[model samples]
Every structure is written in structure tokens, then in C-alpha cells.
Target: MIEMFGLEALSNSAQAATTVGIVFTEAIALYIGYGAVTQIVHQATREFLGGE
Candidate 1:
């Protein structure tokens, strides 16, 4: 099964590191994306509320 996935070429530690790196990258991307969305929503709310 591992060979079918082409992951058999990688050592166990290498596979583990790759998984961790992928997860970390995804987390950072989500954090930044959510921050931008939250900022946009907050700004829109403030404008609707007549706040400076």
C-alpha cells in the first residue's frame, strides 16, 4: 500500500517530518486567512454602527 502511494521511498522519520510540516503550514495559512476575514467583518460592523 505504501508503494502504491509512492511513500515507500521515504524513511519513517522523513514521512513523519513531512506530515508535521504539512500540518504546520496549513495551520499558519488558516490563522492568517481567519485574521483577515475577522478584520473585514469587524470593519464592516463598525461602519454599520456609525463608529469611527
Candidate 2:
């Protein structure tokens, strides 16, 4: 199934490590993205509410 994507045949441990690394990388990316969006919305909301 995996090889169908033209990926090299990695061992089980290697595959697991690769999956974990990919997930960790994506988690960090999503966290940063959401944090930035939240900050922007927070600032906008505060200004709309006339907060200093």
C-alpha cells in the first residue's frame, strides 16, 4: 500500500519514525498557525470592543 506511492520500502521502525516525525512537524506548524490567527483575532476583537 505504501509502496504504491513510489516510496522506498523502509523497515517497520523507520516507517514508524518517519510517521512520528511527520506528525510532530505538522503539529508544530498547525500550532503556530492557529496561535498567530488567534492573536490577530484577539487584537481585532479588543479594538472592536473599544478596549485600549
Q: Taking the tens digit of each residue's C-alpha lDDT, what string does model 1 give over 1-52?
A: 4455577679999877777777798899999999999999999999999998
Candidate 1: stretches off by over 4 Å: 1-8
Lowest lDDT block of 10, candidate 2: 1-10
Show the lowest summed lDDT stretch of 10 residues, model 1: 1-10
Across 1-52, the per-residue lDDT of candidate 2 in tens digits comes to 3355444588888777777787798899999999999999999999999997
Could you tell me the lDDT of residue 46 within candidate 2? 98
Q: Best candidate, lDDT-wise?
A: 1
* C-alpha TM-scores of all predictions: 0.81, 0.85
- Clashing residue pairs found in predicted model 1: none
Q: Any residue pairs clashing in model 2, and if so which?
A: none
Predicted structure with the largest TM-score when compared to the true one: 2
